[model samples]
Target chain A: MTSSDNTERLVHVPLGERAYDILIGPGLIGRAGGEISTRIKGRKAAIVTDEHVGALYLDPLMDSLQTDGIEAVSISLPPGEKTKSFDSLTKVCDVLLEARIERNDTVIALGGGVIGDLTGFAAGIVRRGVRFVQIPTSLLSQVDSSVGGKTGINTRHGKNLVGIFNQPDLVLADTDVLNTLSEREFRAGYAEVAKYGLIDKPDFFEWLENNWKEVFSGGAARIEAIATSCQAKADVVVADERENGRRALLNLGHTFGHALEAATEYDSRRLVHGEGVSIGMVLAHQFSARLNLASPDDAARVEAHLKAVGLPTRIDEIPGELPSTEFLMDAIAQDKKVKGGKLTFILTRGIGQSFVADDVPASEVISFLEEKRKK
Target chain B: MTSSDNTERLVHVPLGERAYDILIGPGLIGRAGGEISTRIKGRKAAIVTDEHVGALYLDPLMDSLQTDGIEAVSISLPPGEKTKSFDSLTKVCDVLLEARIERNDTVIALGGGVIGDLTGFAAGIVRRGVRFVQIPTSLLSQVDSSVGGKTGINTRHGKNLVGIFNQPDLVLADTDVLNTLSEREFRAGYAEVAKYGLIDKPDFFEWLENNWKEVFSGGAARIEAIATSCQAKADVVVADERENGRRALLNLGHTFGHALEAATEYDSRRLVHGEGVSIGMVLAHQFSARLNLASPDDAARVEAHLKAVGLPTRIDEIPGELPSTEFLMDAIAQDKKVKGGKLTFILTRGIGQSFVADDVPASEVISFLEEKRKK
Candidate 1:
């Protein structure tokens, strides 16, 4: 079903008292103040954004908040994955406290995943948690991070190794924000949009294969895809907010994706998160086929669709020299999903038919990587 | 209830799935591993303690864990309120990560409140949470901080301004450890013991007044008092784990207490937390009397009880010149408990009848402080 440019679809995350809504449409950003004022009781907000996002969207958000009689302040940090660190978290927390952001006041994150993760963490800990709102600016964040309540920072050990599951009171996913993201960045986010289909919505994947161009071009199709993706995620989150059971299904490609990101030393110039996810998704399907769990054609279909949307579908597509298989294996072993030194992966019978596989042999993963690298 | 020295009382905090037991008795520290292993699934443990606590108890605790076939590592921090800071939190988190503390593995806090708060916060965030056990080493911690899931670190803004409600899997409140405490420290903790009585148990308060020496000398009376305090706290916590409602009653004297702690710049020599609470409880009663919430005689009775126990009952009893009334008010205003810029204090009608009073007038507090200084 196609949505109009002005049509805003709402996906409600039902986490009991922690339940909240995600508003997906074109101009939610412009209406942020009125929407936030109606939903959140607080009359004060602190908008945390990066230098790039602040320049593009901060003033409009501030103006909207002021128009609604909400006192708003803004803090801009350097833009990049590097900002998702303990130092940035402490700085954000100190500033939030300095601003006297009370328990009732809101801390609005207005950037990509990095800002949402870091800002949500600060909101969670400051005064033992305060009101949090997510104005996720990228498709990756809007579809995935912002909706999950999984806020955290990267530690020396791994990404998102430290944080709390602080659910947002509301999330405003303005499709218009996508217009500002670079083509590469937008494509990176689409990898996650496509991910929903791979996880459990084969029909959505088939639809994306047919209508991806329209999704990238924007309008009704874009809204439907994002709304669908969020709803799928919300279902998983409501079932397992803490990642104890069914929620591991949401990490369909993350174990492989995270290892690839780590292999590149987290150098965005080489592989941003979603791009790593793209390669990871393909590898997951290919590896499952090697284990005789799925057909090779299913993996080929996923790669073709991802490549059609301009996302890298193979590790060889990544820029610069690749790390050795042993390094990648070490990265995989260190993934936070590891339980009791046993490797867990999201393997599939086919597209949209994934299940969490525990105790996947390290030798199998090693041989799979060795063959894939040679390709 | 009088009991033998071998009697171990258990207070269970039933917070649904987050529920746990507080074991109040002697020799609990010696059986930490056995108790923890039976409850928590993981066999790996990290013991976080203070230098003072570690020097006295680490080896014995480690030996107990080793006996249970649990691999254990210990991190000893500096002993003091100063250790409850963001820097220390980061250090502890890094060490936990370095030790490869996994989600199921337990983080055992083996000291007083400082170690408990800091270690619990780290456990709550590392890998997005792990099993945690608290072995409170002081009377105040055993009776108060260790029971509730209130984990945090102090910031420049105020105490416990950064934290999360991370409950422990088990609390080992070994009364034997309190024997190592200095007299001043034990008395400071006694103030909290008295607070449980003053808050809502007039009978407990009267009982303490009659059997003060027996409770102090340690045995059946001490276990009963500590067990009663834990039960009282657990009841409040089970009812309102997040402090959204009835739990605020538990903060009866903390508002004034925190302000006093801040006035002395959190200097332990001038006033530790429970000492400030002793004075603050009296101040709360006097303020209540001033407001006619209770009779002046009730305030006098409360002050007499605390003073009889060697706790300072008046502001003048604190060492050094106290800050001005306005300065104290500023500290109160900055308290984490303040909501929407209004003062919220735990006021009382009399002993055993404390309640949360919201929107308290700043002017009256100032006048009360001015009058208090004259005493």
Candidate 2:
């Protein structure tokens, strides 16, 4: 909130020392070097980014740091979800250690969810944790992953099965970088922006439904969307930082979303992360209706808005051959949310009324997947 | 301190949700399955131990678990600091993931510091942290490493330069496990026992000076010593679980001790962790005396006691070639204790009086190592 720019807004994550502000604005990343240097003092930093985002922003970021006498080592990894692996994690850690990045130093995660998760994880374990800052460039990361301190690599068994909850010192959700995203990528990120509304802020969903075109046009509305999304996430994180209870509501569609990602072999071309989440969110609502937890009309409304934004809403929409119900069920069973062989899901009573449901039966999930995939 | 049997004592680490008890006594390992089952419920457990300790206690532990209907799958590793690497960490994580260990499942660290550190590190990262209990079987671990949630593996750069502060659900510091330790290893563990007394409890140091032989003999006195040490560590940890300030005092001899360990290539034979601490503690006092912070007589007394206990008190005691003062200083500079290339040492004013000194000149350390090497 302490900003000179009228277009920017800040949402604070209240974790005491680990607490940080998510600065949502038009061009925050360009001026981040000055802000970063002031926060971390003279400590060295290691910037971890992916090739795609690195090509676009690495120079300006490094140049900004230089302007404030804060030297940094930029490591650009191959872009994409596959890059979030143990190998990438080890490489990042080795780079920081070899750089002799002191414990007092900082690690700047300069990309999307993968970079934020990987770098935050590296920062969490390296030297038993060094300081970390998050500069999320994607809507998914800016709205969700980057603020929650849920950092990890995907294992063969499941997504984000190996990780730590490491809060960053600061989060710069720059709206300007989002303008560079491909249309599909931008729509995918919106899946999460809309998700915050589905989870607990139906009014925001209503706002998006009315003014979404402005959000896509890139300006104050986009900033509002991202800042509102961050505020929702920040509130959840502050209430339950570790996802032990209340924070599970944020996974409004993740249980099915992850299973879909796994079933699609995590091939982004087949079903990008946000697309999978899009379909999954719809599935969640439809499944809730099937279980008499919500009305079918609520599910239809969700699907309509997401489709209007050019996001996927069904497994049939994916371009590749989908796996069988059995395969999808297997993936569901492998979800980290599946506690002690029982299904735990974020189910909804109605729109913006999701709740953690731990007693959901596997038989119900199998039948639901079978019915959905048939289309 | 409330116990039905005089031979048993419980040291409570008051970290609120992270709080746990260090249960010290004879034959607690044989009874551990019951205690573990009761505390963690019917949750499955993955017992991680080194081959050396596994050969001695694994079968009995498994038998105990069976008696309690607590199913467990154990992974025994090759023992030593050498095993603390990225490879070992990856393997441990993969095994747990393959086992489908849920976040609520328990990871039992069933060996010394290497096993405890390795297993705890695995638990910290696996599923962003699984519930972990430390059933430490070595005197060094029972008193120190296991109590603090500082779990990690060594990188090629240095020891414990990568890890996290993940508190255990419980710590079983059974004294019976120490009866099987080699004399040198046992003596090495004693260095940490003496360290707590030197850090702040001068009366405890006086008691240790008088009753060390009885402590070596075992039984009630042994239990008392371990319990007291755990209490001291628990107090520090509860006060500052993250090693930010007061907790640095626990590293009374570790700054020098870790340097010595690095010089000896972390060999168990030339210098086990405890022996290094023994010598480091003596060096810390000598340096304090050299700086006119403590009496020379006090430094000599520490040296005399460690020498009497068959622990190394000088660099001359280590076997093989040691690097020059410049070399030793380089090793110290590489220590994780080194903050941005500046020397940070825990210096003593006298017995039972230590403080964290951040501005110790590197030249002074080089000269001190030179003088110690001459002896």
Candidate 3:
């Protein structure tokens, strides 16, 4: 559901004492200091961002924090997925500790998922934990990473294999920041936005399907979509913060998406995270149809919507030489979703009707991927 | 109260779903696998130990796991406080992931506080968290660190400045392991045992004073002392696992102790943790008396008992030139117990009557340390 005012929307994640609010609107970044001061009493903040995001928004954020009498120090690392590593994590943590960011002080993630994840993990660990805030500059982080307390750094073993579930004290999803994103980057994030609807919000999916243009153009539709997506995620997180049960649903497209990302060696030039999710979601629906769990029409509809929004809906659309089905299968097996040698995939009956299907046959997945790769 | 069955004792930490058992007995290392298998369903185990502890116990522990049909791998790190570091944490996590230790699989810590804290932190972050067990070898670890799941690594900033409250599925405190400890190390650990009594159990403290030799000689009294200490710790941990309130009482001697340790640059030659704690606890009592909060007779009694056990009851006994009082006060101010520039120390009204003292004047602490240093 869209906000009544639509000027701004606040989604409160009710996680008992760890609960915080996500503010989605146009100028939250400029007012971040004011918003943060109201919730977190700390006067000191360490804003961790990548060079790209920091270049565009750091000055304003620092000024806004200064305006609210909050002393914030910004640490800008080189932009990219590679920055989410132990070296970067140590760097961020060392910087935070060196800054003497106390337990009650704030650590703000002023970039996208990489920054938010690394920053949150640092905030969680430094001094056992400190107050954290997220100023998500990307739609992907706004709807997903910033809302959940899941934070970590990737190791040579795998992505996000090291970290903790550290929730943020506040999240400022300023829609105006999306204007700085390239069209490709914007569309990539849109894949995750579309994912929220496919997970459980059928009406939201229908609304997005009809108003994709307005969301792309940026206005009330974008705010509503972000607000609705945040609320959906917030509900899931509140119910199961640790991913013991219902939280697995939020990984709807992540298993296959992660496998695809890994198969591509996480090369963003070939495919970014949201692009992989867009293709993976379609594959999930198609595989569900193959299993007779859903009609093929539903899969077609998902693919159509994603394609219309400029997201790659098929594995064949990806650039570069595709890995063999065995290679892809190996990657999938290595995903964190596997438990006791059994495959756990989020399948569906139709749109907005995803369910975690456990013990799915690997042979079927192999066969399905083999067929899809040929397309 | 000591266990009725003095041969072996069980202290259960009842933390709802996070609850676990602490088993104090002889030959627990040999029976480690049997104890682990019953509690954790996973068949794979990764035992993290230091060269010191691993040389003594790793073989028996591995053999036990193998006998139980649990696949086990051993990672023996260099023994020292230095092993509780980011480099070691990364190495351990990489090895665990490389071994494909899944979520349900157990990560067992088979050494003292350093190994337990580092391994527990790795187990906590790897795959978001994995099943953890602690087979604490040293008395300090068995009675204190092992019972409480406060896992962390020391940063350049301070000790235990980075970590999480990740409870273990089980703690196996094999009393036999203490037989291999140097008398100094054993006596050092005894300080924490004494601390449990000093916090709230006057009877336990009185019992220790009476049976000090029997407790150190390693038989029924030793097991009884360890069990009682674990129970006291378990009670506090169950009440406040996160150190929000009453748990601060558990740090009865830690604030000043940590300051002393920091002053000595954590040099074990000068002052190990337990020895520092011994001196710190005495100082705490003396400082309380100086504040007119406790009787001077109580401080004398504490000092006498600790001194009789060969523990240093005064900072002057640290076997080296100590730092200035101002330096120690700086370290204390930098401690995790400091909140909003206010000192929060565990002070006492008398024996077995420790309470969290907030906003204790810095002037009083400096004067107390100044007088103690001269003595």
Per-residue lDDT tens digits for candidate 1, residues A128-217, read 998999999998998999988999998887788899999999999999999888999999999998888999999999999999999888
Q: After superposition, how far is residue B204 of candidate 2 from its true place, in Å?
A: 1.3
Q: Ten consecutive residues with minimal summed lDDT in candidate 2 chain B?
A: B1-10
Chain B vs. true chain B: TM-score for each candidate?
A: 0.98, 0.96, 0.98
- Once fitted onto the true fold, the runs of candidate 2 whose alpha carbons sit more than 4 angstroms away are A1-6, B1-6
Give the chain A TM-score for each candidate. Answer: 0.98, 0.96, 0.98
Error of 2 at A27 (Å): 1.6
- In the predicted model 3, the residue pairs found to clash are none
Give per-residue lDDT, candidate 2, residue B310: 83
User: Given the true complex, what DockQ would model 2 score?
Assistant: 0.85
lDDT of 2 at B325: 74
Runs off by more than 4 Å, candidate 1: A4-6, B4-6
- Evaluated against the true chain A, what TM-score does chain A of model 1 have? 0.98
Model 1, range B132-234, lDDT digits (tens) per residue?
9999999999999998899998888777889999999999999999998998899889988888898899999999988878888998899999999999889
Instruction: Give DockQ per model, in order.
Output: 0.88, 0.85, 0.82
User: Chain B, model 2, TM-score against the native?
Assistant: 0.96
lDDT: worst 10-residue window of model 2 chain A: A1-10
Which lDDT tens digits does candidate 3 get at residues A1-375?
554555988899898889888889998888988998888877999999999898899999999999999987879999898898988988898899888898779999999999999999999988888999999999889888998899998888788888899989989999999988899988988888888889898999999999989898998988988888899999999998989888888887788888889888899999999999998999999999999999999999999999998899888788888777888888888888789999899999999999998989999998888888777
Residue A362 local lDDT, model 2: 85
Q: Which residue pairs collide, candidate 2?
A: A128-B163, A163-B128
